[model samples]
Target: MISSEYCRLMARYSTWQNTSLVNAADGLTNSDRWKDRGAFFQSIAATLNHIYWADALMLERLKGNGRPEETIKHSLASPSNWDDFKVLRTQRNEEIEEWAARLVDADLNGTVVWYPGDGSTRMERPTALCAVELFNHESHHRGQVHAMLTAAGAEPEPTDLSLVP
Candidate 1:
């Protein structure tokens, strides 16, 4: 199980890494950004969009809402435009941090239940695990974007958690 303090720390780390990622990626051309990189999400923009969508989805569930309307298939839906994407990306990052800011121990000690994008079946998990997974999911996709950025010759800042300051 995780604690509120852990979520807060991870949220800060997320903002730090995201700022670096966006700054570096801004230097790339549209074709370069959207070029198929053969990663899971296929390209930097798509992957980043998926990351943002995942954050929104997890945020709704964490806030006791429900699965987001946007599904995994449509994770890349919206703001293919860099400027708009940046705005929404920053918003989702801030939202994640804000949600983490309000977490209490009791909040993470319980369970969260929801269906996946397909609503295939009901899924239930410890709130603590979901809390941990939120950050985990971000890092997972961001790492893909990080690699894509680097391969395309963009320079994101160091991602070491200790460097989060």
Candidate 2:
């Protein structure tokens, strides 16, 4: 259902889109970014935090490098400030890119077992599926952030994957 090439493309696209969104948010004042816009996550900052949180969770599952407990802990907590968020976000993007660069067919075809962070049970699924999920998840939350950015009068760069350079 997925391939390394596909994963690589999506990874690059995800990084590109994320950078664009973060840059757009950079234009807003701290108060404006954190203001309650009545969105699902209540604010642009919260929504972006959620995306970063999920990215860390899924990346750990995919890469098996980070401690799940620690990743989940930080993700559940909001960044101390925008600078912290951007730093972490940039670091995670680089990690994702590195992982995608080294990915292989076998890696994508393999399965990963993990607790769904609910503490109720564990689930297993193909790495490819999880990889796709990561990209899909980012795009989903980014859509909300994009709307919020526009609503806040900040013009974000275009989001089309084909436009990535």
Candidate 3:
């Protein structure tokens, strides 16, 4: 079982990382930020959008609800531009931090059931495992964005967990 303290700490880390990345990315032009760099999600903007969508879904599931399904491609195209994304991303980062802050030790226990992007079957998994995945998933994609940002000559903050503040 994971403690709520872990959730709170991860939430803090997420906020620190998100702000650093968005700030760094703000230096790039729209075309530059949206250019496909052959990363897994194709571009910095699209990867950020994908993370935004999936994080919302995971948050809902953590609350025992399912979000409307959308294709991976749809998520990639979501908001379709950078300005809208930046606004919504700020809101989401706050929501995620709030949710994590509200958790208690028992909140991470038991299983959470939710449909995937396909929305065909209801799969169940331990809440602790899902909590881990929730933070890990964003970190995974953010790493891709960080690489793309740097390759585009945009400098994001260092990603060391110990450096979170």
Candidate 4:
């Protein structure tokens, strides 16, 4: 079981890393940001949108009575929109921060059941484990986005975990 403090820190790190990546992407044109370079999620915006969708779904599963099936039914092909995505992202960031700040030891010890991306089956595990997976999922896709941004000549901020603030 992970401690609430650790979860909060990871949550903060998630926000920092996501914002840094989006900022880097902002340096690119809409076409470039939306371009698919054959990476996961295909483009910077799509990858970020995928992460947002997944995080929202996981958060609902973790903190709400809803199941993944009852949550988002489709992966967004892009961020909400050129303008709306920023707002949605900010809202999600706030929601995640609040959830992390209020997290309790019991919350981490509890379990979350959900369908993985493959949709093969539903699985259950410790809420802390799922929380770790949630953050890790964002990092995994953001790395893809960062690579795309770099290939497009956009310099994403350093990804060092220690730099989160």
Candidate 1 minimal-lDDT segment of 10 residues: 67-76
- Tell how far residue 151 is off in model 4, in angstroms: 1.0
> What's the distance in Å from true for residue 148, model 3?
0.7
Q: Once superposed on the true structure, which residue ranges of model 1 sit more than 4 Å away at CA?
A: 70-76, 118-120
Each model's number of backbone clashes? 0, 0, 0, 0
lDDT of model 2 at residue 165?
Answer: 79
lDDT of 1 by residue, 25-103 (tens): 9999988888999999899988888888878878778887656554334654656899999998898888889988998
Candidate 2 accuracy as TM-score:
0.92
What's the best-to-worst order under lDDT? 2, 3, 1, 4
Off by over 4 Å in 3: 67-77
* lDDT per residue as tens, model 2, 31-116: 99999999999999999999988888888888864347555674577895999999989988988888899988888887877876
Cα lDDT computed for each candidate against the true fold = 0.86, 0.87, 0.86, 0.80
What candidate 2 gets wrong by more than 4 Å, as runs, is: 65-67, 70-75, 118-120
Report the Cα lDDT for candidate 3: 0.86
